[model samples]
Each structure stands twice: as C-alpha cells, then as structure tokens.
Target: MELDDLIGIARARWRIIVAVFLSALALASAYVFLTPAQYKSTATVFLSINLDQNNLSSGSYALSQNVASYASLVTTDLVAKQVAADLPDLNLSPQALVGKLSSQVQQGTTFVDVSAQDHDPVKAQRIAQAAADEFRKEVQSLQTGLHAAATDAASLPIKPTSPKTTLDLLVAAIIGLLLGIAGAAIRDRLDKTIRTDKQVESATGAAVLAKVIHDSQASTKPLLTDIGEFASRAEAFRLLRTNLQFVDLDHPPRVFVVTSSVPAEGKTQTATNLAISMAKAGHRTLLVDGDLRRPTAAGLLGLDSSVGLTTVLTGQIDLSKAIQVHPESGLHLLAAGKRPPNPTEVLQTQATRDLIGALREAYDAVIIDAPPLLPVADPAVLASAADGAILVTRHGATTAAQLEVAAARLHSVGARIFGSVVNMVPRPDPGAYAYYMEYAPVANKQ
Candidate 1:
C-alpha cells in the first residue's frame, strides 16, 4: 500500500497499535528487570612484523601489511580453538566462543583490540585475555625471530563494556512500536466494513441525503417534540422531508420501503419518526411494520399489537380494522400481527398489492419498515412492491461490503434506491450550542 493508506490505517487503529506496543514494552521491561546483570571486558593487543634496519623503508611497509593480515587471523577458527583450550573454566568451544569474542583493527596503526562478553566481569576479562594470548601466539609462530624479539602484550580492560540497559530498552521499545504499527496497518487493510458516509457514497454510487445525529431525547418520547429540542437531528429530518418532496409527485413514491443491511440499524425508528414528521406537516401518513420476523413498531409507538399488516395480508382481517391511528399525530400504525409460516409468499400475493393500493389512495405517504436486506428476501420483495427504498445505515456498525451487496440485490430486482441515511453520528463539538439556540427560536415561534 501507499504511504497515505498506511497512515490512514494507523490513524484508524491507533488504539490497537498503542495497546500492542505498550504490551510489548511491558514484556521487554519485565524481561530486562528479571534478567541477571551481565558485564563485559575488552583487551587491547599490538601486532607487528620484525624488519631489518638496513632495508627500513621497505621493511616498515611490509610490517604494516603483516599487521593487517594478523588482525584477520585473530577472527579465525584456529584462534578461537586455542582460546577455548586456554580458558577451560569458561567452558566454551570454538563455535560457542565465536559469539562472545570480537576483534577490530585500528586504522593507520598496528594495534588489534579483542573484546569478550559474559555475565561475570572476571570471566569476561579472562576470556578477552585468553583470545588475545592465542592470537599473539599464532602471529609469533609465523616467525621464530619475531616471537623472541616482540615485547608487546595484551592489556586488561579498566571497565566492563556491556549490560547497556538504557540502549537495550530503547532499541526494544522502537522495535515494538514498529511492529505495532505494521500490525495495525495490516488489520485495517483486511477490514472491509463501512463506518462513514464517505465509504457509503464510494461503494454504492448513491447520494447520502442526510446524516442523523444520535439523540437520546428521541428515544424517550413518542412525539417529535423531544427530538425537536435537538435542532441538528430535527433539521436533518426536515432536510430529508424536503428532499422527498423533490421526487415527482405525479408518479410520486408514495410507498417507501425503509430497511438496512442488518438489524438494529434504526430502520424501524427512522420509519416511525419520518412518518410522524410527515403527519405533523398535515400529510396523511401510515407506518407499516413489514418485518414479519421480528416486529417492533407497535411497541415502539405504544400501539395495540393484536392485529396489523400480517393479518390484513393473510386475508384473516380487513385492512380498515388492521390499521390503527396514532393518538398523538394521527399517523396510521400497522404492526406485523402473528408470525406467518410463508411471510415472503404472503407479502408477494395479490392481497398485499391490493392493500398497498388502498393505503396509497388513503394516505399521502406509506413508510414500510422491512427486514434486513442480507438475511432474507422479505425487504427486496417489499421494495419491488413499493415506489422506492431507503437504506438506513448505522455509522460504524454497518459495513461497506454489506451495503454494496444490498444495493446490488435491490438493483437486480429493479428497486429504486431513494437515498441513504447515515444514522447515529456522534455530536460534533462539546462546547457548541448553536443547535440548541436554533431550537429555542423554533420552540418560541411554535
């Protein structure tokens, strides 16, 4: 993925990334705290070649080359083997000793430094001295005269070289952080869920008519008065209502099927509220509970749940008797009465069509709250009967893939998608009171 995509993923999954990183750091800290302190010692050794003074010029250059060659030999297996033999107490073989020992040659100089790391300072010092002694012996074996003449020796380190706790923790923390970011990015790429209006528009190629802000007030009252107090949500519904008017009234979409990709996305609530709002504006409206599987409109609106659309469609009851008028707003309510065995067949019958036609002639708008699109074919069948359908999606709950599939299903059946409504958007700012201020003037005007 590109850098921007990686950045977006990181931003979205910041919490997960942080959690992972902190967890890794916590583990590293625990390990460091529990680990025994380790000390290291380094010894310095000088390598040189014996040269005749009569040929001093060429001898110095040759001696310098020999010193460079001796540094390479210090890292050889032969040197490691000899060092292991010299330091028996350390109990390290050539293979095991390689990790503990390191050698470096100084530039423009004939000195080579040998370093060893271990848990104990004395062991570290002994290992460094042993490796240096072994290397020195190998160098002298090349020439007996040089072995007898050489006076340079290995020196003991004044201080321990390791257990750099601060550096280790810093490096561990950095590694942990990078790993966390990478994991977060991967998760974001794998997630195909819709969380915003931007995703809906991009996926479905449909206009987002309105984004309804979540109002706890709307949940408490049957009337719009409670929601009217929150101007933002009320205004959003008003805008939706106005947009609905723009659709040609001659071939008007009188019956609108409101459903979602899944349950609990406020489809029923939207239908109820939108119907009430239309009724309040002096338009005769009817809200039908088309979801025979799990009906909830009757309870939500405090209406009698004895008989509704299901009874009327099944030819068990008459349409007039099945419909009930709301006491507060005069909006009609039609609940899904007694679950039926063949809900899809009942909905697709001639009786259902006749009932819808009768409701259309009687009411200005008929808003049907149908089942989820993905789980059943009930909503698609209802949408085919209705003039159009509105897909209600809860922000951060519904996914892009689900909505796309739902739209495709609707299109396959020649169902017109009226528009999409993004529900449950959180309040934008904490301090802003403009919505409340607008409500005050409207309330006073009312």
Candidate 2:
C-alpha cells in the first residue's frame, strides 16, 4: 500500500492499535517486576609459559593454543565439585554449580574469565573465585612447563543483572507497535462496508447525488416538511433535488423509484423528503407508496391509508378520490392502501403501469417509495415501469456487493440508475458547512 493508504487505515483503527500496544506494555511490566533478581561476579586467570629467550615467539603461540582448553576446564565436573565443596554456605550441588558457571577466553590473549550468577551476591563471588582456583590447579597438573595464577579475584556485585528494566521495556515497546500496525492492516482488509461516496460511485458506476448527515431526531421526524428551510437536513434534500435535474438536461427523469439493497436504510424517508423538497421549489410533486409488502409512507405523512393505490387499482375508487395531500408540504400522496397476498404479482399487472403513466402526466415529479431490491422483486418490477431508480444506501451498513447486485437487477429489467444517495453520515465539520452557508442566497436562509 502507499503511504496515504497506511495513514488512512491508522486513522480509522487507532483505538484498536492503542489498546493492543498498552496491553503489551502492561504484560512486559508485570514480567519485569515479578521475576527474581540475579547478581553476577567474574574472576580472571592468566597463563604464562616457562621458556628460554631464543624460543619466546613459539612459547607465546603455544600458550594461546592452551588458553581455550583451560577455559573449558572451568565448567568440568571436577572443578564444579571442588567449587561446591569450597562454598559450603551456598548449599548447591555440583550440577547446580555448573549451571551457574560460565567461562570465556579473552581474544588474542592467554587469559580466561570465569563468571557465576545467583540470587545471593556474596555466594556468586565465592563460586567464581573457587571455580577460578580449581581451573588454575587443573592447568598446572596438565603441563609442568606452564604456570597458571589467579590474576583478578572476584568482587562482590552491588546490583542485580537478570531484570534489565530499560532494555526490556524498549524491546517490548517496539514489538507492541509492530503487532498493532499488523492487526490494523488485517482488520482493514476484512472490512467490506461502504463508507465514502467514491466507493458507491465506483461500485455502481453512478454519481452520488447527496450525503444525508445522521440525525437523532430523524426516526421521529423524517420529512423536510416539519424542518425549517435553513436546517442542514432540509438543505441536503434540496441539494439532491438540484442534482436530479442535472442527470440529463435534455430529458430529465420525471418518475423515480427510491429503494435500497436492504431494509431500514432510510429509503422510505428519502422518498418522502425528496417529494417535499420538489414541492417546496414550486413543482407539482407526488409520492406514491409502491411497497405493498410493508407500507409506511401514508402513516409517515399522517394521511389515511384506507383508500389509496390498491383501492384505485382494484376498481373500488378513482385515483383522484384516493390521493391525499400532505398539509405541511403541499405534496400529493398515493398510499399503498391494504397489502395484497401476492405483491409481486400485483405490481406486474397492466393497470399498475397505466397508473404510473397517468400520474406522470398529472404531476411535474413523482417518487415511488418501493421495497428493498434484494429481499423482494417489487422494486425491480416498479423500476421497469417507471423512468429510472435512485438507490439509497446507509453509511457503514450497506456492503458494496449488495449495491452492485441491486444495480445489476435494475439493469436486467432495462431500468436506468439515475444516481445514489449516501445516507446517515456522521455530521460534517461545522466550519465546512459554515463557509458554504455564508454564500447562500438570502431567500434560502429564510
């Protein structure tokens, strides 16, 4: 991924990253404080050769070869047993003493260092010193021409060495940061929710008309009829209405089926508000409740659903007698009336198509609030009878795959997708809208 993509993922999942990092640091802290402390002490032995001045160089080379062998003697069973006997207060067996002891030959020198580590500082020093003495005696017995002596006696260690606090914490911090970033990348890869306008446009190959900001009061008051003209929600619907006109300047769509990929994605609310917005702009608008499976548009506008589209289609009443008017927005409404047992079969009738044709001539704009496309075939059938469809998708809820399928279903029936609307976005930064509203016309502000 590019730098910008990484930055975006980090910004989106920072909480998860921070939580993982802090948990790692906490675990490291617990380990550092709970572990037992160990003190280390070291003792050095030097080897010298008894040689004549004529053979000085050969003697030095011989001593260097023997240095490594002497260092190995420090960890032998005999040396460990001897050291255990000398440090009786330590109460350690020969095997335990060998585990505590280590030896290394100084590079380019005939010298060896024996070290021991233990919880008791004084015992550590005694073990090192005893091991060095035993190694020295063993070297003397091996070669009479060589002399081995204790060069530096072990000293008492003042501090513990096992718990290196600073280094351990730094390593933990680096590992934690790397794990956090990897986790965030994995999460981003797995997420399939549609979030931005660009994603919807790319998936459906249609322009985004508007983004409706999330409102807590939207569930109770969904229509722009009750909201003021200057409110942000009303302004969003106005932007949608204006964009609809630009989709095709030559022959703009007069009747549109507003639906989504699934239920509760604000399709019903979008249809009602779009009709109100058109009426507010001095156009004759009519909102038809085309969803026979679950009708809600009539109740949303406080109208009577007892006599509507179904009543007119069944020859029980005329269209003029069944249509109700929303008092607040002056928009015409055609409720679904009573739901039928077979809604798909009902929407496919010739009468329904003729009603849509007649309504087109009676009104300047018409919005049909239809059921979700994926769950039922009602929206696709209605779109085939209407001019086009306007897909409504909820932010962080609808997946790109579902939107693609919905668009494909419409296209299969020769229905055009006018555009899409991204609904329930988080409120914008106040400064962003303030700058645009500053240049708004005076009449719009009122």
Candidate 3:
C-alpha cells in the first residue's frame, strides 16, 4: 500500500495503536523510575618519556605516541589488579571491574583519560583518581630507565556522567512510536472486514443501492410516519424504496427474503420497514416472519401472535385467519407462529411455496423476514422460494469474508441474490443524504 493508504488505515485503527503505544510508554517510564541512579567520574593524566643526550628525537612526541598505544592496555587485568591493590573499598576483580572503567588517549598528545562508574558520586571520583595513579606507577616501573619519573598527577572530575533522564526518555519515546505504528499496520493487514461501500463493490461486483443512515432513534415503527422527526432513517428507507422500484422484476418481486450473514444486523427491521413503505405506496403488502426458530416481527409490531405462517402452513389455520393487519399502516404480518421444531424443513415444503404463490397473487409485495444465513439454512431455503433476496449488513460489524461467503452460499443454492443493503450507517454526512432527500417531495396535510 502507498504511504497515504497506510496512513488512512492507521487513522482508522488509531485506537489499537494508541493502546499499544501507551502501554509501552508506561512500561518504559516504570523501568526508568525503578532503576537505581548511577554516577560516573573521569581522571586525566599526562605521559612522558626521558630524552637521552645522545638520542634526542622529539622525546615528548614519542612519549605521546607510546601513551596512545598503552591507553588501550589500561583496561587489562594487570592494570586493574594494580589499581585494585591501591583501593581497599574497591573490592572488584579485574574481570568484574572492566565494565565499570574505560580509558582513552588524546591524538598527538601524551594525555590519557581513565573513567570509573559507580552508584555513589564520591566513590566514582575516588576510584578514577586511584586507578590513574596505579596505572601511571605500573607504566613507569615497566619502562624502567626509558621513562622519567611521573611529573603530572591525575585530577578528579567534578560532574557525574550517568542517569541521563532526558536522553533516556527521548530514546524511549522513539521506540514507543515505532512500536505503535507497527502494531497499527499489523492490525489493519490482518482485518478482512468490509466497512466501506467501495470495498463491498470491489469484492462483490454489485453497485451499492443505498447507504442507509443508522437512526439512533429508529424503533419498531415504520420510517414514513416519523420522516419529519427521524429524517435520516426516513430518508434511507425512502431511498431503498425508490431503488427497488427500478429493479426489472418479470413478475415484480412480491416475495423478498431479507436476511443477513449474522444476527442483530437490522435485517428484520429493514424488511418490516420496507414492507410498510411499499404498503404506504398504495400496494397491498404482507410481511412474513419466516424465521420460525426465533421470530421477532409479531412482537416488534405489538401484534397478536396467536396464529401465523407456521399455523397456516401446518393446515391448522387458513391464510385469512393467520394474517394480522397493522393498525397504523394497512400492511399485514404473518408471525412465525409457535416456534416450530423444524423451521428449515417447513420453509422448503411445496405447501409453503403454494402459500407464497397465493400471497404474491393477492398482495403487491410480500417481504419475508428470514434468519441469518450463516447460523441456519432457513434463509437460504426462503431465498430459493422468494422472488429475490436482499442481504443486509451492518457497517462495522460484518466482515468482507462473511458477506462474500453468505452471497456465495445463496448463489450456490440458486437463490436470486439482489444487491446488498448497508444498514446501520452511523452519523453520515449531510452531503450523502442531501441528494436523496432533495427528490422527496414536501409533506402536505389534507
């Protein structure tokens, strides 16, 4: 992906990144706060060699060159042992003391520096001075007559070199930021869900009929009556209604099985509202509760659920007795009826087909609210029987993989797969709905 695309993904998944980043920073801060403070000190010394009268060739320069080489050997066991003997408090062995001490020589000069680190500032200064003194004595002894007596002394450093809080925090912040961005990228790559219309169209090759704005205020009631109060929800259903009218239905899709990949995606509400809207347009509409396992249409509309589709299908009651008419809109409802044991089998029967055929002849539109496709085969069976199927998906809840699998499953069974409906679109921009709402005529009281 390009940098801009990656940035967009990061923006979408920013919560996960911030969560990981904050967690890492908190751990770093805790580590820094809990760690013990350590101090460091340095001691400087000048090296020189005695020049003979017979062979006087820049004795000071030669001493400086020799000292530069010898400075590297200062951290060896021999120098450390000599330094250890001089200090009673510094009880560290040569190997153990190597990490705490360092030495460096100035270029083209006879000066060498020996640095020591410890938790205590005073002890660090004392160790640096003592180590340089011991090294100087050892060098003079080893050189014998080649070097003069040591004229220069080592001086203790005034400042501590460790516990650099500012530098530590700066490094920690950089590490934390990298970790955050990496986490966000990983999460974005791993997720295969479809949250946008472009993704859905790219995956399914189906144009988005409408982007339904989710109404926080949308209830069981139809959108037409409350179009003025809940403008977004009313506008969404109206757009969907207009789009359906354009579909080239040979016999006009009287039976539409509205379902989703999973539950709680607003399929039942969409089917119910769609049916109500169709009925309001002077068509005799019948909303069937095909999900016998967990029927919700009758309860949602506050209608009598004494007898419904199941009762009519089982020959216990006729269609006229089973169908319940809504008090507000003239739309009729066929509740799932008493939760039958074998809902899938009931929906696939020839009797059910004949009943739907009869309803299609009698009504202008018949919308069947079926169960989720993934969980059960009830919707698939209903889809096969219905004229067409409208798949409903929630914006952030449903994944691209799930939607594809659902559509493929419906297609596999020869179910007429109509275009998808993106439901529960939260807080859509005014521009998105402005174009659709402009076409809707202003309401007038008769």
Model 1 misplaced regions, further than 4 Å: 1-4, 54-100, 120-142, 145-166, 169-174, 211-253, 262-266, 276-284, 313-320, 325-331, 394-401, 423-446
Candidate 2: 10-residue stretch with minimal lDDT: 436-445
- Per-model TM against the reference: 0.74, 0.82, 0.76
407 in model 3: Cα distance from truth in Å? 1.5
Tens digits of per-residue lDDT, candidate 1, 1-446, equal: 78987777776678888988888778778777787666666667765555667766676677677776776766678988998888888788898778778877778876777777777767777877888888778878886434312233334444444445677678778987898898887777677777566798876667787788777776675346455545677767777788888766687779999999988888888888888888888998999999988898888888877799877776788888888988877888988998889899888888788888888888899999999999999999989888889999888778898899889889888999888888987666655657667566888788
Evaluate all candidate structures by whole-model CA lDDT and list the values in order.
Answer: 0.79, 0.90, 0.77
TM-score of 3: 0.76
User: Lowest summed-lDDT stretch of 10 residues in model 1?
Assistant: 145-154
Order of quality (lDDT): 2, 1, 3
Better of 1 and 2 by lDDT: 2
Q: Superpose all Cα atoms of candidate 2 onto the true structure and report the RMSD in Å to 1 decimal.
A: 3.8
Best by lDDT: 2
Order candidates by TM-score, high to low: 2, 3, 1
How many pairs in model 1 have backbone atoms within 3 A of each other, for residues 3 or more apart or on separate chains, i.e. clashes?
Answer: 2
Candidate achieving higher TM-score, 2 or 3: 2
